[model samples]
Target: MPASLSGQLVVAISSRALFDFEAENEVFEAEDDHAYMALQQQRLDEPALPGVAFSLVKKLLAFNNGGPGSGQRVEVVVLSRNDPISGMRVFRSAAHYGLGIERGVFTRGAAPWRYLRPLSAQLFLSTNEADVRSALAAGVAAARVMPLSRQASAEHPGELRIAFDGDAVLFSDEAEQVYQRDGLAAFREHESERARQPLPAGPFKPVLEALQRLQHEPGMRIRTALVTARSAPAHERAIRTLMDWRIEVDEAMFLGGLAKGEFLREFEPDFFFDDQAGHVESAAAHVPAGQVAAGIAAG
Candidate 1:
């Protein structure tokens, strides 16, 4: 039988999203691919530092007993745009960090999101907005990782805590569309009126489902939280929606219009995902964060 990633939480991440390549990225941004490739080749033996999502990736990879794609509860693969030569450094860096990431696809400047389907990836984390948008459009949950986001806390070595936004993330942007057009009062009224009705599942719903499955694995410790800007009457619908879906969240914060950074600082999630860039930017200061880039609000 062919090796498969079935029955596992598979995450595909870009090289820059996994490791700190900002300095090298600056060189690539100068429109000098040759220089970038040469730099990577020259630094092949030097391990790159961890990036924003490093801690989260490290924790998630811990769920695997064997290695990536080895029928463990989790599988993480490098789906990068770097050339094969540059990819050597990525693998070397992973090895140096004691990360058992043995699977990768080096596309040499091409969009790697196309392979997310074949790989059965539940999530795609990349620093490129276009790549993330492409993956989201293709029915894959993708996040444009905030490169400057704070690293996750090391205190939770025995547990994995993930956070998510409500609208346009775990739930569809239907309410968000109303909020954007008719204002918050109308949005709240709409949600309150249909509090018992479940909102449709959004782009990241599949990723949440994957995590839900991982939560059930023996000896696995996974904590999920929903930190949203919805408060009071509006919050009821969101809670009811989750209840309808039978998804359990360890924590829920209905902040209304308050800034999410301070609260997230207290929670110290391994990673946080939000559909709005503003919220993501704020949360980035407190935890490893990423923007979902989904729904009407993205426009």
Candidate 2:
């Protein structure tokens, strides 16, 4: 029988997002695939340095180490556009880092987001904007991981904390456009008007639901936060949306356009996801950050 990913919190990640392939990626972008493939082949024996999402992935996979039957609770797979030969290095690097990642799909240069369906992945992390958008379009929770973001500290070894922006992330960017086009007063009024109506689902909603399920499992030490720029009147709709979906986060911060860096520094999340570049720029300095390149922000 085929291997099963059922009943698992499956995460589908790209090679670049898992490891520091920026140098090779530079070649791939500036020159051609042949050069990049050659470089990857040459570096097959070298283990890659951890990328932005490494700590988050490491901490998440740790949830599976409770002995024999524990592995059934979580699964992480490499879903990349790298060629099969380059994929060799990916597996080798995982082994080198003592990561138990075993499954992979190498598509050479083709788009890999399509495989998320078969893998039943609740989260898809990649450095490719197109891939992230494609996955989000397919109803998968996906984020364009910031490969240059600060790595999470080893301080919280046992707990996995993840932070998320409210608009264009857990909820649709419909409200964000209001704030961007009409300014703060209009945005607040719009959200206040629609406070009773749940906002439309965004790219990260599926991942939140998956994490909520994981939180219920025995021995799981995952904590999630909703860290947004919305406050007071605007915060109600975001809260209502989560309530409507019957999902609850461990924490929520409505910063009202304030800088999120210091607050995230205190939260110490293994990873943080935001749709706006400004928030991500601030948060990345303090915690590992990924940009959800969806909604109006990406445009």
Q: Provide the overall lDDT of each model, using Cα atoms, as 2-decimal numbers.
A: 0.90, 0.88
lDDT of 2 by residue, 1-299 (tens): 98889888899999999999999999999999999999999999999999888988887787777666555677999999999999999999999999889999999989999999999999999988899989988988888888888788788777889999988888889998998899999999999999999999887887888788777665548888999989998888898899999999889999988999999999999899998888888998888887888878766
Candidate 2: where are CA atoms >4 Å away? 218-220
Q: What TM-score, over all chains together, does every model reach?
A: 0.96, 0.92
Clashes of each: 0, 0
> Can you tell me which runs of candidate 1 are displaced by over 4 Å?
66-71
TM-score leader: 1
- On lDDT, the leading prediction is 1
Q: What is candidate 1's TM-score against the reference?
A: 0.96
lDDT of 1 by residue, 121-232 (tens): 9899999999999999999999999999998998888788999999999999999999999999999999999999999999988888878877766534889999999999
Global Cα lDDT for candidate 2: 0.88
Query: Cα miss at 43, model 1 (Å)?
Result: 0.9
RMSD of each: 2.0, 1.9
